[model samples]
Target chain A: MSWEIIKQSLPMFQQGFLLTLYLSLIGIIGSIIVGIICSLVEYFKIPVLNKILKVYIEISRNTPLLIQLFFLYYAFPAMGIKMSAQLCGIIGLIFLGGSYMSAGFSGGFNGVNKKQVESGKAIGLSRWQLARYVIFPQGFALSIPALAANIIFLIKETSIFTVIAIPELTNTALDLIGLYYNSNEYLFVLVVAYAIILIPLSIILTLLERRVRYGTFGN
Target chain B: MAHSGINVLFEGTNLTRLLLGMWTTFKIAAVAIIIGLIIGIILGILRTFHNPILRFVLRIYLEFFRIVPTVVLLFLFYYILPRQMNLHMPGTQVAMLVFSLWVAAEMSDIVRGALISVPIHQKESGLAIGLNKFQLYRYVLVPQAVQLELPATINLITRVIKTTSLLMLISVMDVVNIGQQIVEANNQKYPTGVFWIYGLIFLLYFLIDYPLSWWAGRLEKKRLEQTNGE
Candidate 1:
């Protein structure tokens, strides 16, 4: 409500915002790489690694990121595996996000038609060639919507990094409220800041989804 | 380092306290989901109406909840509402309130999708059979939609249950908070206890959530089979 407080707090919020953006970017990229590897293992029906990845995916998907972060940040120190809060936050996000992304990617992999694979084989495409020319592109196209949803979910989840003392936007707003007691102004800024970040990202993803849906890659 | 980390869980009433905390988590999630389901059904039915203003308003509500993180909303209700509106509700109640609104927003969309997915011929057949509006929905539309909505509803229930972990942020003394308290109390005596305490919390959540997810998957598979058979 007050412009004066808003101006005063802008720098702190900017710093928090950048941290959040940085962490989310790292989390998204890390999870995508993880997802691709896991999906590939599943698609190829790799023996021991497939079973291990399955259990990892199940445990990761079933647990909340908050508790996972608690385990990493607080519990690990006791086990002589200390990590910085930022490190914990980054690891926790990828640990959680990777499972969800792998599920999405595998769903896409399953959706790639058997006929397509057969035709690729019929055309003398080797195993790697079959996957490269036949499966990955179509599967990636099919997975676009799921990937977008997981991205949004991961971004929103970064709010909880505040619990481990990361100075993300949520943490910054709480700090300002604790200090100034201007809960209205700070909360307003928090919501608007989130909206500003999330709304455009969602719109862009939707556009991306549309392009994938109608584009020639899948068809 | 001298003692095992597992000792902390069995020592004193730590285990009992953690179980009680899990109950509180369930209590909050149960109340929120019930309230959300009732309101969401109403809103969803309204959304199926041809009113432009109502549709627009509902869309805004859905998008707002979807875009904003649950933690931010928790802060708004728990921190801001008391000072701004002179409301002095407890943190648990505020958590329930925020989660209820969120679940309602999500459920309404699910309901709307299910309702519209019912073929137009069914509604027309009900009308031709002299069924009034209420009777039409009760006899013809809702039953069909309910079947379609069941798997999605189960998935939502699992989501709400898992999300209750956030209640600890508001200092509601849920399972996670209680675990933290146990770890703090036993830090000297059981230096490795933090791992066991949080690992138990993680397993507890997995036990509660995995069954529901499995059931939802089963329902989804059954529905798929039925549709493919038809």
Candidate 2:
């Protein structure tokens, strides 16, 4: 309610916000790579790798990301594979985001027209070339909206890293509240900060979805 | 390396503790889902009503709830609400409130999508056959939209169950919290118990969620086939 508390807390919140941004950026990129690899594994039916990826995807998608973070942060250390909370959190997000993105990308991959694949073959395009040139383009275009949604979800999921004490935005807010016992003031600012980032992202995603739905692509 | 902690989860009260945690998880998730379904149906039906201001407000409500992390929402409702409003309540109750709000937002979207997907001619034909607006909705639109929305609602049910894990973060002593406690308690007894405990929790969630999701998918496919046939 008061601007004084907000003024005092601004620096901490800003730092936390930047850390969240950094984590989300890394998560988004890493997960996209993971997603593409998953889709490729599925597309080619890569023997043992495909089966492993399917189980990974199933486990990641079904279980809560909180438990996943706990497994990586708490369980790994118990097994003597120690890592920083930030690293574990980001890795968790990547795995989680990748699993969700795999679903979207597979839907897009299946949507690539059969005739298009036939035409590529008729043109003597090799299997790799057919996938790289003809298939990836249309598949990615078809899947852009779902991909954006996954990115947004990943960004939100980064908030869970606070559980492992990663000092993200939510953690920073809680820390401030702990220090000042000003839950109402700090929590309001916290929600606003999240909304400030998320609302614009959601709007952009909405526009992107509309464009993709209208068949606007690399034309 | 051998897992010295293998017996931590399987031995004695450890398994009982984990089961109790699962019971709490199931209990809370069930309450939240049922309450959420009722609230969601009402909100969803409200969303279908023709009012611009109401629609705009509902849009903002849905967008805000959908965008905010469940963890944050849990903190706000469980921690901040009591502080801000001077209305103290149990964490479990606050969790139910926050999650029901979330489920309602998600469910409204599902219902809205289903309503939109229903063919316009179906409604028109009902009107032409002398059905009043109430009769049109009751007899024609509601049935079809509910059918279309069923699988998505079931999907949301799985989501609701999964999200109940967040309650642990708020100190609600759900399955994850109980698992963590068990691991911590026995960490000294068997230094590698964390892996087994969390892995079991992960498997527990998978066992619960996978079948529901599979059923949702199957229902969706069946609905698709029926529509295609029609």
Candidate 3:
């Protein structure tokens, strides 16, 4: 709990913060790609894959992120593929985040008027063109708020990566706690790190969403 | 490239460990759900109470739980809370307390939202029928509110069960912890089964979650059908 311990550990803590940022950045990109692809398949009305993807989305979204991480980090090694805990953690977050992203995006698509699609068809847009110009643009705009929330969720979910030995913000805090063995010394500071990582990001997301929703495109 | 270094899980020799982990997972899930449901109901009602003070308290409580990550909360409860307050409690016990408090707040919000969505006409009709406010809420409001809330309620159940995995990080030896144990023990001996162990855990979760989601879907469909029929 001493200032000396906290001061000395500053660099250690920063390294962990950097790790969290790196993992979350990669995870967010991977998840958004997976989400967009899955959403397109469902929106395009793919027959069999639609059913599988629907089931995938439901199961992944309903289960906790912790369980998903554990299954990949702890259980996968037994199944024969040797995965580092960090890789397991990252992949699990991507899958979990992607599934949630798809759910929100699908809801956005559902919110779109069916006539919008028909109008695109009438304009002689190919399926890809229709999706890019007419469908996805609109759905992405509508889904932005929810998508922002999902990114926040992804940030928090990454905290659990500590259990799998990934050197992220939470693990750094826990490691610091272990070293100090004093709750007040590092615990509250860790909470601040978490808040720091999330709050501004969320605020910026909200402002950006409002801007997009109400700026020129909205008109 | 030949994969090596994980032996204990896939060799099929540690069936007992997997079963043990599975049993522990179920046990924690069962207790967590019961705790979650009762508290969730009370908190739900608390958020809607007439007292502004109570409502404010509930709002703060909800916001705190909503934004804070569960793992951080778990670490606080398991590692910090007791020490700061001078209590000596076990990890699993603290986990229950922390999760119950958190889940209650979430469930309460869901319940309140569902209750508010009930048509105003239903309340007016109840008053016209000469039912007291308490009796009206109990018989008329509660039933309809619960029916509307059931799908989300089931969803929260899955969320609670899955969250028990956090206990593993804190050394509670739940299913995930047990899986990790077997993997660590056999990592040198069998080196290849880690994937299967994880795959089983993955399938186990999907297996449990699938039916609940299906049931929620059916409940939602029935609600819609009832609405359409009306």
Candidate 4:
């Protein structure tokens, strides 16, 4: 393997890294919002929506992310709507991420003290106001560890977007590696590239989770 | 391409192809679950130890496995492990290795979580009843931990099943591979074979997964009812 050639191509690969970051950032933020909403819908026990949301979460959660990507990428366009690959990938990620978020957020919701809700009601708060002011913060704090784990999972899963031909880190690495008869060099480089992205993210997640756990305990 | 051509896809052997796909999928899933459960439990306990070096080593193992995507992990074991280490195994064996490590890491986390979830009071109560520490764990702790662990364990099983699809990317002749091959073979006769072929695979996964998942939800619900009943 020519170190010089790889050294030169590093810029292109760096661009791919940016794309992966962009995709994951958008996916995480969008899905967290989606997840919180889904959790609330479940938490408040929406009458007709309760069953619909439950089934939706189940389907999204049970199947593989890859199949979901395929559905979004291949199935949707055939129905006469067009979307960019990145959009499809993001949407797919959000769908999976959102479902996961519901579980964590709801778990956190359940962790909130029952007294807190009762007190809110005692104070003559409307349901929405009680949920917004009293319930969400406590629920959010309690579910932080589980929520962080899901976000970390979302980061790891972003690599699957490579299948839909997004030039993210995994795809970029695989592209370069595929050219080489020496598969070992490529695989190592790919693994290192992954470690570079994931390890720091893992540390950040751990620290965030610990901090959240501390706050929850203090409360 | 747009709306799924699922109807055309499952026209004839839809049921058979789905069953075949699931048979293969579940075979991999079944093996992975059993092996993953064993490995996860061992490592989880290893992680709970007071030994600094051992804890550090297990932490690194857990983080490494957790960080690497299963697809990349599979590729490492399938392509590079043999070249660098001369440990040549069949694709299935290589996949088992990659997934076992993955399973081990995640399961260990679950095990750790379950163990911790058994209230500290419960263990103390056992002690108050004159039970020793190890005896307290064996008798008072493990069962409750198992109950909490069941749902998460089911989630892991579902994950392993879904992940097995990535095996096809590396030419593993899995359910996806089989579907692709048949689709390609019939491509000349029907231009839309890819749709039906893959769609069939999708249904197969749903068929296999939905029921087990329903059971898991039921377990969680039963837990709730029991707690409510109490």
Residue-wise C-alpha lDDT for candidate 2, range B1-230, written one tens digit per residue = 45477788776788888889889889988888888888777777778889999889888889989888888898888776776688998888888888888898888888887887789999899999999978887899879999999988988898888888888777887888888788777777788888888889999999999998889879987876675567
Supply the TM-score of chain A against the true chain A for every candidate structure: 0.94, 0.92, 0.88, 0.86
Give me the displacement of residue B91 in model 2, in angstroms: 0.5
How many residue-pair clashes does candidate 2 contain? Answer: 0
Q: Model 4, B151-198: lDDT tens per residue?
A: 878878878888887877766657777776665555555555566666
Q: Name the regions of candidate 4 deviating beyond 4 angstroms.
A: A1-9, A46-50, A76-82, B1-18, B121-137, B188-193, B221-230
CA lDDT of A101 in candidate 1?
A: 94
lDDT of 4 at A171: 84
Model 3: per-residue Cα lDDT at residue A171: 89
Q: Which candidate number maximizes lDDT? A: 1
Candidate 1 C-alpha lDDT tens digits along B1-230: 47898999999999999999999999999999999998998899889999999999999999999999999999889987887788999989998899999999999989999999999999999999999989988888888998999998988998888788899889898999999899999999999999999999999999988888888879987886677567
Rank order (by TM-score, best first): 1, 2, 4, 3
> What DockQ values do the models have?
0.78, 0.76, 0.46, 0.54
Which pairs clash in model 4? A75-B2, A78-B1, A78-B2, A79-B2, A79-B3
Query: Per-residue CA lDDT of candidate 1, range A1-219, in tens?
Result: 889988899999999899989999999999999998899998888999999998998788888899999999998998899999999999999999998899899878666767788899999999999988889988888898899989999999999999999999999999999998988888888998999889998898879877876764546
**Looking at model 3 chain A, which ten-residue stretch has the lowest summed lDDT?**
A72-81
Order of the predicted models by DockQ, top scorer first? 1, 2, 4, 3
Q: State the C-alpha RMSD over the true interface residues for candidate 4, after superposing those residues.
A: 2.2
Return the interface RMSD of model 3. Answer: 2.7
Runs with alpha carbons beyond 4 Å of true place in candidate 1: A112-131, A208-219, B225-230
The 0-to-1 C-alpha lDDT of every candidate, in the order given, reads: 0.91, 0.86, 0.78, 0.79
